[model samples]
Target: MHEMSITQGIIDICEQHAGGRRVLSLDVEIGELSSVVPDAVEFCFEACSRGTLLEGARLNILRIPGRGHCLDCGTDTPLTAAFGSCSRCGGYRVTIETGEEMRVREIEVDE
Candidate 1:
């Protein structure tokens, strides 16, 4: 899964920033639309963190719900896994707001 690779990348970045310090925790924001499975990512975290500064680190995943704005009706609606479609006005043209992000929101480490 790509989440494994992504987890590895996060560990790499954390290791670079930690500078030999022990990683206490990692706060990650996973968007619903990002297609990342929280359980799968968490499962891979331990493997990815092996021998790194983030080894045995606590991984905190914050789920960010998908949000969208209807362009035709200007209605803000919660997005489902389905394609772009306005829930209020039934408009087909919808602008996605947030919920497509996957990023390391914060990282905690021990000095």
Candidate 2:
């Protein structure tokens, strides 16, 4: 899957910031609506990190819940999918507030 490439990207970011230091752990954020599977990423991390600074690094995945604001009902509700209906009025006019993010949040490196 694409997680291999994504894992490589994570390693690249860690190496860039680690400055040749060995990475001990990493914190990554994955949104519910982002469609990037955390398990897949975790599975790929080991294979992708081999021979890199993140080889033995522990990966911590933070799952973000999806949220949306309904324009018709003026209500904020939890969303489970990309094109989800509003909970209040069951309206389709909804704007996403969060849960579309995928990024590396923190990195711990060995001194």
Candidate 3:
């Protein structure tokens, strides 16, 4: 899975920022529309963190819901998919406002 690579990237980032310290915890935000599975990332984190600064680190995953703005209805609505119809107007002309994100929001390291 791509989460293996993604998890490695997260670890790389954490290690770079850790400044030779051991990571204690990490907070990551995964958006619904990002096409990345949180469970897969969590699973990969354990394997990828072996012998790294993130080893045994607590991984906190925050799931972000998708939201969109309807161009036809001029209303904001919840989106479950990337190309979901607007909930209020049932229109397909929806522009995504959020939920296309994947990022490491915070990291804590032992002093």
Candidate 4:
């Protein structure tokens, strides 16, 4: 699954920022529209982190809701998908403002 690759990327980022210190925990932000499975990422993290600096690191995921602005109605609305219709106007002309993000928010390292 893509979560395997995504987990590897997370490990890479943690290692890069760890600076030889062992990672104790990681705070990750995954948007609802990012298509990245949180469970899969958690499972992959255990697999990918084996024998690595992040072997026992705790993974905390923050799920962000999808949001967009309706161009036709000029109103901000919550979106469930990438191309969701505007809630206010029921129009397809919506500009997504967020919800396609996957980033490492914080990394806690051993002293």
Best by TM-score: 4
Clash pairs, candidate 1, are none
As for TM-score, the candidate ahead, 1 or 3, is 3
Q: Per-residue lDDT tens digits of candidate 2, residues 16-46?
A: 9999999999999999999899999999997
After the best TM-score superposition of candidate 4, give how far the Cα of residue 96 lies from its true spot, in angstroms: 1.1
Candidate 1 whole-model C-alpha lDDT, 0 to 1? 0.86
Shift in Å, residue 106, candidate 1: 0.6
Model 2 TM-score, all chains together: 0.96
TM-score of 1: 0.93
Residue 61 alpha-carbon offset, candidate 3, angstroms? 0.3
The segments of candidate 1 whose C-alpha lies over 4 angstroms from its true place after superposition are: none
Each prediction's Cα RMSD?
1.2, 0.8, 0.8, 0.6
Candidate 2 clash total? 0
| Deviating ranges (above 4 Å) for candidate 4 | none
Measured against the true structure, the TM-scores of the candidates, in listed sequence, are 0.93, 0.96, 0.96, 0.97
Q: Distance from true position, residue 79, model 4, in Å? A: 0.6
Which 10 consecutive residues of model 1 have the lowest summed lDDT? Answer: 78-87
Give lDDT tens digits, candidate 3, residues 9-100. 98999999999999999999999999899999999998889999888999999989999999998999999999999999899999999999
- Candidate 1 per-residue C-alpha lDDT over 1-111 given as tens digits, one digit per residue, 9 for 90 to 100: 888888888888888888889999999999888888889889999787888889899999998888998888889988875376788988878777888888888899997
**Model 4, span 1-97: residue lDDT tens:** 7899899999999999999999999999999989999999999998899999999999999999999999998999999999999998899999888
After superposition, the stretches of candidate 3 with alpha carbons farther than 4 Å from their true spots are none
Lowest summed lDDT window (length 10), candidate 4: 88-97
